[model samples]
Structures are given as C-alpha cells and as structure tokens.
Target: MAIICRNTIEAINHLAFRLDLGPDDVVVTTVVEHHANLLPWRRYAKVRYVECNPEGTFEPDAVAGALRGNPHPKLFAVTGASNVSGWLPPVGGLIQLSHEAGVPVLVDAAHLAPHRPLLAAADYLAWSGHKMYAPFGAAPLVGPRRTFAMGDPFLAAAGRSTWCRSTRCSGTLPQSARRPDRPTSSERWPSAPLPVPSQPSGGRRSAHNEHLASRLRSGLGAIEGSRVLGPGPLVPTLPVASFVVEDVHHALVAARPAAEWGISVRHGRMLLRPPLPASLARD
Candidate 1:
C-alpha cells in the first residue's frame, strides 16, 4: 500500500506512527543517512548507528554485525544513495540481511529516484515527485497494505466513514452519509494512488548518468589538492561528485565560480556527517 504525503519527511513521520515505536524499540540506520531519515526515529524509538567507512560506504557484513545482538529492533532504515557523495550502497544485500533477522527495511529514495531504478527488495520506499521532474506537493510512500492497517490513521477527516449509525435527533442525516461497510483496499488511506508511467527502453538514462559521472570524477581528480569523497570514478554512482580543496573554505568555492563564470556548484558539509556531541566538538 502506498500513501501520498506532502514530502518525504511527512511520509517518514506517518511510517513511524504506524510502527508505534516506543522507547525500547530500536531503529538501525547508517551514519550516512540524511537528517530526514534519522530525526523521525528519535521521536519514538532509540536509534542505533551503523558506522560507514570514511568515504561513506558500507557492506552487508557491517549491517549484520550491528544486528547480531540487538533484541528491540523494529525496522532497518537506509538511504538508496547519498545526496552529497552520490554513493550507492549495497541495498539488496543489506535488505537480505535485515530480512533474515525478521526486520523490515525502509529505503529513502529522494536522491536515487531521479538517477536510477530502486531495488524491489525494499519493504518501503519514500520519494518526492519534484525530484523526478514533476511539480511540487507530490511525495509518495509505497509499501505493503498490512503495514498501514496496523497503525493509526495518518490523518482524520470527513468521508472516511468506516461505520456510521443513525441517531434519532431533530436534524435529519442523509442515508448516503451512513456508510456501514468497511472501506475497500483502495479507500483505506488518505493518499490517492500514483499514476504509473511507461518504463524507459534499455535503461539508456542510467548508462548516460554513469558515463557523465566518470567524466566528472576524472576532471575533478586533475585539480591540485582536490580530495574526492566516496567511491572511485569507475564505481556505480549517481552523476554527482563532492570534493574539498586544500586551504579553501567551501563557501568561497561555491560563491567565487558562480559570480565570475556563472558555474553553479554546491559546497559545505552537505549534512551527511553524523551528529556530534557539543562536548566532543569543544575538545
């Protein structure tokens, strides 16, 4: 079952509500996740971090190690691709590992949806329509129908009449308003079904993205003192690259080029870093 939400964050919040996560429950996620995937869990469950390599990559063994002794884990949430480094983690292997432990997996596909296909192994997928060339205000969470039925309603409004009774009062209620039958499968949620589009022939877009990513990485590598983050150029990734130049602040790197040559680029620690304690930062 899928539900339409205002954004991916909203979808996550609804999923959290459905799970009825409590203080004892734990949600296993990676250190490379965006804040949207992490913060929602903090509200209702304990979050366990799976450390990634310095370049923001992890394998299935690392995930298995994290889940070995944990007893209260309810879900395993991860991102399909890194928004900053564009690293595509081993999602299929990770999903298999989590399922072996009797846990469901949720995939945050905000960045990957635009560049590549998502794996069918994921239990839940959350994505934004704007990322895929559509207008804003269209984000959908696709998952099994049983999951949503197990939780509270995402939102309550009129016309969602499950069982209505007629009371003898001064005011007369119309019979059409007294719907006693249970809602059908399609009418169980607030979100409407998303339209399915035609699939691309032969995956031409994915091939093009890989070719461009290789060229971008090669060009960035030639610059002096440039340190590229995440996987190497030949590895599978989105057509995005992030690098830091020695002795240069990221803000200046982003500004100077756009002002001088009209070349727009993003800069700064792109929110992929894990949250640090204030005391640790002071040290």
Candidate 2:
C-alpha cells in the first residue's frame, strides 16, 4: 500500500534517508520547493531560506520574517502548495511559528498533493511525482520520532528491489508507518498506501483532487489573461494557474494548449522562485 507516487523526488529521498542528516544539520527551505523538496535537502542539510511575499504568499509574518534574520536554524522546510501560485503555505500558522522557534517543520506537499489534505502538526511531509496525478512514482515524507529512519542496506545489496526498508513502510501505512507499527521500512519497498481517510471524500483530503480542483476553478474562471492565485483557505487549491497572457508567450500560452488539445500546462521560473534571472532562466 505504499504507493507514494505523488509529485516525486522520492519524497526528498524519503526525508534525507530518514533524517540521518548531518553536516551540522540545519535545513529550512521555502521559496517554493519543486526541486524535489529542494535538491535532496540541499545535498544533505545546511540551508535556510523562506521568502515569498510581494503577494506570492507563504506568509506567517513572512515566515517569521525569514526566521528573524536567519542564522543557523534546526529545520523548517515548507510548501503545502504553490507550484507557481496555487498558493497555500500558512500551514497552521507555519506550524505555530516553527514550534515557537524550537524550529522543526517540513512539508513540501508537491502542489498540495493535487489539491489538499495534510493532517497538520508536522515534523515532515515531503512530496512530488509531477505534482500528484501520478505518472511518476514514489515521493512522500511525514516525519517525527527518530526524525526519519527506515533502514538501508546499501539499498539492499544493490539488487535494487525498490531499495528496501520494507519499501518505505508497508500496506495501509501510518501506525508509525506500520509493520507491527514500524518494523523498519518493510524489508525494502512495497506497501504503504491506505491511510488517506481521516475524512476522505470531499469532506477533505484530495477528495478526487478537490473534485478535479473544482473543475479547474470553473475552467480557469473563463480564461483571458487569467487571474487566480491562492484563492480560498490559502492553498487547498487545484486547477492551478498563474496567468498574465497579453502579448502571449507564457510558453506560447502554455504551448498552445499542449499543441492544440493535448493540454498539459505549466510554464517557467517557479523552481521555488528565486532562481529566475538567468536571462529569465532561458525562457
């Protein structure tokens, strides 16, 4: 049941190899991570950034004002939504101000798992797989106790049987990732997809992706240079859009509806945001 194919980066390498993180551990990302939850936790922890205002959103007093002029944080990664302004990161007031500064909050909810649903109170919650509708497989991180640990035997003598650790928690996960309630990543991958019901079915949690994102926000609100960023409840959104058409070329209006009718959508410069200006990042 561990079918975690939702916006993939193997959920930040399953939370940095289940937080065996080092190099003076100090992770805290936000600028809108899609680089698979920010480059494998920035190639193994030691990063701190949380900025995205000027109305792009991810505010909690602008991430506690960038964790008060930053300088060595413990951990505070975020993104419960905002794959180019579907916008959502207030996540219970940024997990109560990064636990009142004891600092520990990870959530990359890759475009908020196709629409929305996060049980809140987080220590971790990574995401990805081309943003949740599946076509890329595996990516999820929901950490705490032991900060993240599933077990790795050089990913099992390199037979690569889905890199073991009981396939990262087995069938019907979340009883602390199951297996008599956690027996170590289920002997190397395969089992962990059945805990999506704290209130499943439109009452909450990806209820068929918020009913196909409210039919893509009523068809991108009848298009025309569009306008819909982080509407309602901050970011429990889908039908994701970030428009400004006019002279066109937002990749040719998203590639002329995917070359006339194929329709897939998604343009540039949202690689967590700041990485633009390399000549508008090779448009």
Candidate 3:
C-alpha cells in the first residue's frame, strides 16, 4: 500500500483535481481525521468540520447540514472509524447528503481498513492498504472512473508523490537492472510504488483480532458506567476499544505496557487538531 502520491490528500487531488476544481470547492470533513487524509484537501480548499456527538460517533445530519451550507461542495471527507474511539460513522446517509448536493464524497478509510467494509458508500474513497494486513507504506484511493478523471496532467507531471520523496525518483536511477537498450515501465516511472504484498488475510491475525473483540465485549459485559458507541453487532473493531476509565488519562492508559499485551493502540481524540489542546501536542 505504498502511497506514491505526495500524501493521501494528494492521491485524492490527483484522482480528482482536474474537474476544474477550485478554491471555492468547499470540502466537508469530521474533526476526527488521521491528518494524512484531512491536511491535503483542506490545504487547497475550504474545509468545514462536522462535530461529533458526545459518544464520539459522528452525527450524520450535521454532515448533511454542512454540505447544504455551501452551494455545491466539491468534496466531503469522513472517517470510516475513529482511530481513537474505533467508532464507525454513519456513512450511507452522509453519502446521500453529499450526493443530494451534487458533491463527491470521500471516506478516509485509514482506520477502517482494519474494521469496516472497504467500499461502503463513498464516491471517492482513500485508505491505507498497509493497515489492512498489507506491508507498510502502501495506501489506496478507490473511486469510479468518472471521479478519477478529475486528475490534472500538470499534477502528474509535477511528480508529486506521497511515498516517493528522494530526488532519485524524480531524477535518474543508475541502479537500473534494465539492459542498456531496454526501457522498462518501472524504470521510466521511478516513483512507481508497489502496494503492500498481497497476503492471505484469512489467517491467525484475523482470528486474533476477532478473539480480542469478543474478549473485550465479555470483559465489558454489564459494566455499570460504560457504553458502546456506533453501530451495534460492532462490525469488527480492530482489537481496540475506547471506553472511559474513571479519572484515568487515556494517554497514560494507552501508554501502559499492558496495552501492548492485547494490541498496540493509540488513545486520544480521533480528530487530531480541532479538539486537542496546544499543550497536548507541540506546534
């Protein structure tokens, strides 16, 4: 899942940048993002943040309202699940809202790659394949051909690749294995990134995550103060849970070595910027 584009947002832009999209192309996204998904689209466009409910699940109607705020939102972004809370959002209605407004919807499936169904209801979807039992460094941008046609040739020519950073990619690679007279496509496109190595996902990792989900639910059974968030029959959250621990700092709890015993996890607001205080993260 190597993201060859400069970033996930760049992948989105490269996939849809040509439809004469402009600064006025208002974009709507939830405050909860992986930074990779939110930054690029917001960088070149107006981004409206949809608020999450108290339980951390996104209010689908708020997203619909935001899309209605602008005359025609060029794009809408949302997470398949909160990286922090492991909450899958109400995507169907949100997609409907954007479509009703003639806007294209893009789901940041980075976290959901390990949880939710891959292509639920987004017009232009972005995800990290590396997260989906694939090798590190790969990501995916899935969209219909019509949506992909928005890509601009200039963006392509600029050689803006997310995973490709070294000048060697844009320049020349003398390490070419190609014969002197043979010019291969991979040699020509030095930045060509390979997606995560295809692996048979139906294996121990799957069983392990599934077992973790069951164990977590059983452990939380009839808890006096805790409540589950998002859809019921919880569609396989990644060996991760986001319940509150009274008087406990999530950061500290997440940092505890015990967390590694189950599965390594990060704890915080899924949306990195809007809710986090300056002190929590350095500028």
The whole-model lDDT of each prediction reads: 0.74, 0.58, 0.57
Tens digit per residue, CA lDDT, model 3, 183-262 = 12232121223223463254555667667866775575456655554434446555556565557677775676455677
Q: Write the per-residue lDDT of candidate 1 for residues 102-156, one digit (tens) a residue.
A: 8899999888877777778899999887677666666778888767653224554
lDDT value, candidate 1, whole model: 0.74
CA shift of 139, model 2, Å: 2.9
RMSD of each: 6.9, 17.9, 8.8
Top of the candidates by TM-score: 1
In model 1, residue pairs whose N, Cα or C atoms come closer than 3 Å (at least 3 residues apart or on different chains), thus clashing, are: 1-143, 1-144, 1-145
Candidate topping lDDT: 1
Write down the TM-score of every candidate: 0.79, 0.30, 0.61
Who is ahead in lDDT, 1 or 2? 1
Better of 1 and 2 by TM-score: 1
